[model samples]
Target: MRKLKLQVQMTIDGFVAGPDGQLDWMWIPGERDESIFEKVIDLAESCDTILLGRKMTREFIDHWENVVDNLPDSPEQPLAQLMVNMRKIVFSHTQTAINGRNLEVENGDLTVAVQSLKNEPGRDIMVYGGANFASSLISLNLVDEYYIFRNPVAIGKGLTIFTEQKILKLDSSITYKNGKVIDKYLPV
Candidate 1:
C-alpha cells in the first residue's frame, strides 16, 4: 500500500493560512534558502499522486497552468510541471470535472475513495490542503505521514491544525537547523 502523506506549510502559531485565506505571512521567495527549496522540490518529486481540496486545487491549477510561464526561471516552474504531470484527485462536491490529463474528480465519500487509492500500487500519495479536508483525513486516521514546513512567523489567529474530533498522538518530531520542524503522528 502506498503511504498517504499530508504536506503543509504552517506558521509557528499552528495556522496554515491567515483568516482571509491569505498565505502572505508565511515564507516568501527571498526568505527561503536555495538548499531548503531544493529539498522541498525533491520531496515533491517522490509523490506520484496529489490529493487536493476543491478550493486549493482550483487556485493551484490556475496559477500553475496559466501563470507559471510569465514568471522567471525558478523552482516554481519545475514544481508546477511536476504537479501537472502527476495524477491529481480533487475532492469536491461542487467541482463536476477535473481539467488535466492525469486529473480525476472524487466527490464520493472521502474515506472510501482514499482507502481504495491507498490499496493501489504506486509511489507515495501527497495531500496538499485546505484545513477542513486535512482534518477529515486526520479524523479517519487515513494519513500515514505529515511533512510540515514550519515557518518562524506566528499568526495569532487563523485555521488551526487538527480540527477534528479524534485525538492525535505525535510519534516523532525533528527540528531542522533552518527553523523548519517536521512532525510525525500515528493514529492511536
Candidate 2:
C-alpha cells in the first residue's frame, strides 16, 4: 500500500492556526529561502495524489491554480505544475461536486475512502490540512508519515492536529537558517 503523509505548518507551541483560523503568525516578514521552497517541491514531486479536508479544498485549489497561471518562471513553478496535475481528493460531509480536472469529492466513510486510495497503485498520498481534518486522521492513526514544518514563534492557544497523545519516533530533522524546522516522524 502507498503511504499517507501529512505536510503541516505549525508553531513551536504546537498550534496549526489561531482561534479564528488565522495564519498570520506563519507569514513572518523576511525573504523566504530558496532551499526551503526546493524542499516543498521535492515533497510535491514525490506524491502523485493529495488528500484534503473540504474546508481547505477551495483555497488550496485556487492558490495552486494561480501559481500555475502566474508563476511560470519562479522556483515554485515546478511545485505549481505538480500540484495542478496531481489528483486531489477532498473529504467532505455536506458540500459536493467541485468541477475540475483531477479533482474528486469523497463523502463516504473516511477509512474506506482512505484505504481504497492507499490500495490503488500510486506513488504516495499527501494531506494538506485544516485542524479538524488532521486531528481526525491522527486520531484514527491513518497517517504513515508526518512532515511538520515548525516556525520559530508560538501561538499560546489555538487549533492542534494531535488532540490525543500519541508517541512518534523521529525519522529526521532539518533546520533552516531562518530558524524554521522540518521534522519527519513515524508512528512509534
Candidate 3:
C-alpha cells in the first residue's frame, strides 16, 4: 500500500497561518532558499497522487498548471508538469463534481476514501492542506507520514493542523540554509 504523507509549512510557534488565515509572515520570493524549494520538488516527485481539500484544490491545480505553461525551462517545471498531470482527488461533501481531465471528487468520508486510495497500486499520496482539512486527517490518524517544513519565524496565534495532540516519532530532519527545517515524522 502506498503511504499518505501530510506535507505542510509551519511557523516556529506551530501555526500554519495567522489568526485571519494570513500567511504573509512566511518567507516569500525574497527570502526563499532554493534548497527548500528543491526539497518540496523532491517530495512531489515521490508522490503520484495528490489529495487535497475543497478549498485548496482549485487554487493548487491552477498554480501548477500555470507553472507548467509558463515556466517550461525553470527548475520547478518538471514538478509542475507532474503535479499538473497527476491524479488529484479533492474531498468535499457539498461539491458534487469537478471539471478536469485528471481531477476527481471524493465525498468527504475521509476514512473510506483514504483507505480505498491506499488499497490501490500506485506511488505514495501527498496531502497539500487547508488547515481544517489537515486537522481532520490528523485527528483521524489517517496520515502515515508527516513532512513538516518548519520556518524560522513565529506566529503567536493561528490555525494548526496538529489539533489532537498525538505524539509523533521523528523519522528525520533537514535544515536548509535559510533556517527552514523539514522534519519527517511517523505516528507512534
The best candidate by TM-score is 2
Ranking according to TM-score, highest score first: 2, 3, 1
Cα displacement (Å) at residue 28, model 2: 1.7
Tens-digit lDDT string for candidate 2 (9-79)? 99999999998888899867884877888998888878899998988788888888888888777666778
lDDT of 1: 0.80
Task: Please say which candidate is ahead in TM-score: 1 or 2.
Answer: 2
What is the C-alpha local distance difference test score of candidate 2? 0.89
Give the per-residue lDDT digits (tens) of candidate 3, residues 1-188.
99999999899999998887788877656776887877888888898999988987787888888888887787778778888898988899889797754899988579988998899997899998989999999998899999999989987999889776799999999988778899999999
Worst lDDT 10-window in candidate 3:
26-35
RMSD of each: 2.3, 1.3, 1.6
Each model's TM-score, in the order given? 0.87, 0.95, 0.92
| Candidate 1 local Cα displacement, residue 174, angstroms | 5.2
- Please report how far candidate 2 places residue 150 from its true position, in Å: 0.6
Clashes of 3: 0
lDDT of candidate 1 over 75-174, digit per residue (tens): 6787777777888999998877978657789989998999999899888899879887887888788988877778888989988657746555787776
Candidate 3, 157: how far from true, in Å? 1.9
Better by lDDT, candidate 3 or 1: 3
